[model samples]
Target: MMVRRSGRYTTWRGFKDFALGKPPDEEKEKPKPEDDLSNHDEIFLKSIVESPDFGRKSEPIESEEDLVVKPVSLDNVNIIRSLSEYRGNNIRTIEQAELAILLSRIHFKALIDAHDAIGALWLQRGSGIEEPPKQDKDTAEGAETSPEENGDMPVETVKVVGLRKVPGQPLGLTVTTDEHGQLIVARILAGSAAAKQALLSIGDVLLEVDGVQVDTEEQLKEAVSKPNDRVTLKVGPNLKEKSSQLTNKLSCYMRALFDYNPKEDTLLPCKEIGLEFKKGDILQVSDRKDPNWWQASHVENPDVVGLIPSPELEERRKAYVPPEADFVHKISICGARISKKKKKFVYESRSSVQLEGAELALYEEVARTPPFLRRVLALVGTRGVGRRTLKNRMLHEHPRRFGAVVPHTSRPPRPLEENGTSYWFVSREEMERDAHAGRFLEYGEHNGHLYGTHLDSIRAVIKEGKMCILDCAPASLKLLHNSSEFLPYVVLLAAPGIEQLRNLTFASNRNLTEEDMKQTLEESARIQRQNEKYIDLVITNHNNDTSYSRIMDALHALSTDHQWVPVSWIY
Candidate 1:
């Protein structure tokens, strides 16, 4: 019959003392609540305590034969010894011994699982359900077979991996199953942790994740989806051949079509690869193989390399148009009104406006034309006289022979403008400093911002062997007439007589009032009468198409016909 205790039994204490090789101490018995054990626990304890040679010293098992009849107590002793040896220490007291026993249980459990898995794998290998082809030593030494030659044969390899996780981010590897039912790596994202590690490669088969064997793509994905900060994986060898293809780089220059905001795009790999460009920026395209995007750098800033939308994929911003009537027209009307007010002030003061010595010298200098190596075509006109429209037409007609001088402005760039392309965007201080240093040929203030034509900017176009064209203020002509190197062939674009002006339609959104038309006529008449000596040719703009043809004819005559030039250019 089995002995039963009525009061509480210290089975755990007894076991702990036994494992630690400590003698049990005798004391007075104390009554406590009885804790019952389940059938499994009772059986386990009985197997451990009632076994023969439970506490006997024994030799270490050296052969397989010795392990066949090993007792349960001996096996427990071996497990404890193994754990202690692994930890580089020995179990000393009851508490330490108990903790060591628990840890040893867990360690053995994991070891048993790993051993079972390895055993199953070996069994499958021996069973010959599927086998790899064997190569003869002599034949392998003579000639190695290429991967392509091994048509349908599966190559087996193994690898161990550890992947660290970032909070709420993916592993950044795309995987798919090959024809052999092996999960293979397809793509690695540009900026992911996996990409940084760079241990895995395309065409490498995935074997297991987190110790779970993965045979299919679904299994691999599910295993990787577990919630863990770090992960481990087993993978096969990479089978892809080393490529010998060369990269061909082509150089191109283009203008940015639209604005780019990198934060708005999710697919960009990193900040370095995100191409942030403003409209009208000239880009140097170095790679154009991608259908939707191209690798490029800013022309003004070559160090900035990134991906930008292809010309086919991006919509370009249209040319800028003034909110009101053309700026040239506004300038002319304002000048006329100011001159009329000044004359009225002079009459009230009972003083006649007379030219002083300095003023007479300035007028005489401007009246004399200077010699020039090349001619700058300057278009001058009153309000709504079609100066800009005619300049654009001339450019379209003669693309190779002419180029426009992009002006400098001390104003912030608009959304569709870029520095050195639409306009040379600069600060007020820089523009003022340059102006004081005589770097500008002509400078003026408009809308509370400074706008000017720099000498170097004009020469930049001239250096390209093309005639420089400008639509400028009348004051600029006076300055140009004084310089021998920059003498302009001034063309005054005049409004037609009142009858023809009434018949013509203006191409602006602002309503052309009678007062506005009247002011334009007066301004045109004043320009023709006062600047007749400086004007090379005066063309009345009645019809756009007809006027364009007449201007082209005039330009042709100027280029071919001989005219008077200053003696300085001849010398």
Candidate 2:
């Protein structure tokens, strides 16, 4: 039913028209404005737009709406028409004058708009308001308006800015009087009331707060303390100069190793704005300009900035130095007080050399990462707890998923013992040599045989794609906790109440005394206090079966829930 034609020339012409656009003759005709722009006026507007001093960019005029043409006043049009009729050639002589006329009109319109926005606030709305007498002008023409120091220096222009008070939030700034006796902003905390308003900046001079002249820092503080919902601040801001007090943002986070109560800190310049956080709370350390104090906010709420003690400040104040004999590893123990007891900590690394670290797990740098199964789950406990029973049950119940790092021993194999199954059999000489080389995490010469937990043994289980269940004493906990190579999730198996512990079969089988059980609880408390930051979880050994199930649930969570780890582990 359809007729086909070659029509190759017609198709080619159509394609050419699309690429090159319609010819001028065939293009749509747009109706011109009834009163068109004069050549001089058009050139004047274009010159103003193109001028760099005007700070405007030239854009293509696509339509009448885009151009936003405002017709000249009828009176001006009549004057121009009359001038053209009298001296047609004269119109070109003063064409440059149009730009001046256009600029004046724009300036006048801007003034009206600004007055409409803020002029009403200038009125004295309440009683007891007295206007200060005006002073003679001294600033040079086009001088910047900013906060001015009170004495000696030539006066600079001051701008009065209004700020609304936010309830239950600190003013988010600290003030101090300069040597010139003028109140100046010492710090402007990020995300605080002043920061959000953006009208105040660090180093701004405070002239008045809520209509009260603030010549000193005390006056500024008192004025800000008023219960008014809206407060007016007269400050001199220097937009041209940058203040060194402005904090630079750092992409870092710190986990609080110890509880901090700001009210107790005597050195805080402004105690009310000090940051308070409990142990293990992660903080986003936004600013670290000062070595003694840092600007930080909780990770859960980063909008409010507060001051917290710096790592250097806390390190010097809270550090507990141990004796040389027990300083086997001099690494920083975050949140833990160093115990001087030789048996509680390693005497030295296996290499016979002390580990080189001044690390006090004091504010430990942390990073959030994707869900990952930890390589090791190290169990630490007192003697009376069913810690060993719980760990063995996990291995027996899920051998494919859980594993144990076989401890190395130099003793001869007993009747039923096997080489690798029972223990990694080794010669005493080799054990001594390895222990001296720091190959063993914790080693000792017991009776005539050498026994120790080897770091390499733990690696073997992890290599097999199983989470190694490491049963080690408290002495080895520090080494494993800090080692990125092991990434152990340390859990402290605590003993239950003495009465509850006495009801256990294990306690009865050994004929443990009440005082012995009481001593175990005391030792458990001491261990927890020393390594509070390093411990990920604590489960009381009320029932062996219950503790086993609790540990299994936690192990499963390690693979499904996001975890926060030391930054050094990843980077």
Candidate 3:
């Protein structure tokens, strides 16, 4: 049969015969040019097909009498004497049986030492200690004992606990296991049976439930899950230090982004701490140090305090978009035409003496429009689009008349930042609470921290009789436009073309990636298309000097020239 040898097929009967314990067929074993087997292959074949007698079989014995028994003789053996024995005839010695026992004990101790060394090495490699050291058979049999009998560790003190549960109501406590294999109370739900009792605390180790010893989390859960309205538990106080300090009281305001139902949530401890709010409802945050939850109350009703999800401010900001932007495409075609017709009608009506009731009301409203005392210059753009640089330049050029409002943030101040100069550093609870209370003119989250401009802070600048210039997110335009307190002049700071942007000397300093440039371009296009109506001016920021000059000219016009105002503001 043909066999594969090296890279070629060859009809070699020698290997087949050799494999079957037969001698090689010399004629068939002859090498051919087509058979590319190397010297190594020949040597391998010869080694595998060895002679039948290579590993010789022993011959069977004829009978049991053929075996001979031999004994070692002590007559020819020389016994060596110890040097100490020759010097002193009174040397203390142990009995033979006792000596054998001592030797066995020493051997066992050596084995245990070697085992411990191996276990230590394994632990150092992060595998963790596997099993306890094996005790000697005799010692192991009598080693079983209680903790008190060992007297090496403190004995745990167990306390009996009884909690009542209303039918179909939750027990309001969650359980988990610690490293020591103790069942611990993880969370006590508010307003539930466990929370009301005040006996169960977070980190309490559960020893028994309903008279049955419970060591595992599953056992404790099963014990508490019984149909009965009453449950009993035996627990021990946690010896470890508390993980978080309860002394700090953080305060803030927040708007609910979603609805929460305490009864439906298994993680909630009690109804008292269960916060439920509608989509737009603002909440007053009292504490936010908890890792997963925050304590807050509704802004309208401070007494209704409860626990709510501690979501980042960015999450809430993502939920907001200008209402008009949603239907920009539908209104874009007719918007300009309708605006022109209304303007023409107003202009023609102003010249006429007699007018309709609606037209007369409009005339009166426009006539009563208050003159601008101070105008807020708001710069809007995507991230890394030089809004901050432009604002800083404007302020630097006109520091006396133009001022910037210090934004408030829920993030910690950086090493170089001051409390009121760089940012108004506040806690998440405080930021959220104030935001929901309508204290902020604009707010958004970034990098897990809440950032917003408070209305009061802006008013403080206006109160000083200085115009406030802010570079803010596009989402804040509508809020600022509607506010009469600070008549805001919205300007879209469009990003220059990618080529122009890259050529700028300051572009490299911004550390902008390809994706960032692409996003900025996309966002610029979105603002122009969707929010064109809200934009009073557009500056394609190709050159810093040119853009600054244009901004100055626009600000000058808004301040000195006759400008249109909203009818609602006049009313």
Candidate 2 shows a clash count of 14
lDDT of 2 by residue, 59-102 (tens): 33344334222221212332332232332223354654563344
Poorest 10 consecutive residues by lDDT, candidate 1: 343-352
Best by lDDT: 2
Give a tens-digit lDDT track for model 1, residues 23-78.
56875433332254434564565456546675353343354433232111212332
Clashing pairs in 1: none
TM-score of each: 0.36, 0.68, 0.36
Candidate 3, 347-463: lDDT as tens digits: 011111122211100001122233354468888876656677888877888788889998888998788888999888999999878866767766767778887788788888888
lDDT, candidate 1, equals 0.59
291, model 2: CA deviation in Å?
2.7
Better of 1 and 2 by lDDT: 2
lDDT of 2: 0.68
Q: By TM-score, how accurate is candidate 1?
A: 0.36
